[model samples]
Target: MSFLRRLTQAFAPPPRAGLDRHLAMAVLLLEIAAADFSRSEEELGLIRKQLLTGLQLDASSAEALLSRALDRSDAAISMHEFVALLNEELDAAGKRELLSWLWQVALADGRLAPHEEGRIRQLADLLFIPHADFVQTRLAAGA
Candidate 1:
């Protein structure tokens, strides 16, 4: 191996698939979080708690995952990147479950901003989830 390549590889952090999943979810959440044209600290806190309690993430791990999520949010071009990961990791049923969780985030601020609803619909379509199921999950998730 080349000297710099070997040196960099030696120091590089290990791969973090769990962190990637959480960050992907964060990208989707942040998209919804900003749907109201404002991203509040309250919204961020809710997102973190959802990731931690809802997704069963540990505290430090959740925080680390959130850091990467911030980076991923800045770099994302389309929602597809986030959904693609979920598509790969989750089956249709699991995707449906995630749809509910997504709605929870969208509605957490107490109102579903137009853009937030649109983003959720867009992601549901990309994930190949049916509209009926999407709506059902949304309602169940309190959206």
Candidate 2:
């Protein structure tokens, strides 16, 4: 590479791996919200709110991320790929926090379906969250 190119590359901002992780997290939240085959406006609102608050993203950025997540979630055949990305990107506490967010999403519509609970349990196991922490997060989310 040329000297100027190398210098410019060195000074350039890092790639948006953090944004990718945020997108993965948003996909998980969307999955939980859609699990019951009932996607309420309240649930979507909560998802946007969580994305804004958790990632400290501006409204536009959150919306874009949500848009991407929605597309990715739709194209996905299983949670395995999303869960794998999350496992690679997040630590234990982060995964637990994600579970908490998921519970919040599940209960956002003021009711929890049986399928939603089952989905949460499945995701928790896939994310390697301890059963105790899963229960605690469920209680914390008032689910």
Local error of candidate 2 at residue 131 (angstroms): 0.2
Per-model TM-score, in order, reads: 0.79, 0.85
Question: lDDT of each model, Cα atoms only?
Answer: 0.79, 0.90
Over 4-91, each residue of candidate 1 has an lDDT whose tens digit, in order, gives 9999999985554454566777778787787778877878898888889877999998888778887777776766657777777878
lDDT of 2 by residue, 8-51 (tens): 99998545444468888999999999999978999999999999
lDDT accuracy of residue 13 in candidate 1: 54
The alpha-carbon deviation from the true structure for residue 86 of candidate 1, after best TM-score superposition, in angstroms, is: 1.4
Q: Give the root-mean-square deviation of each candidate in angstroms.
A: 5.9, 7.3
User: Which lDDT value does model 2 have at 15?
Assistant: 50
Q: What is the lDDT of candidate 1?
A: 0.79
Evaluate candidate 2 by giving its C-alpha RMSD to the native, one decimal: 7.3
Best by lDDT: 2
What C-alpha lDDT does candidate 2 achieve relative to the native structure?
0.90
lDDT of 2 at 5: 100
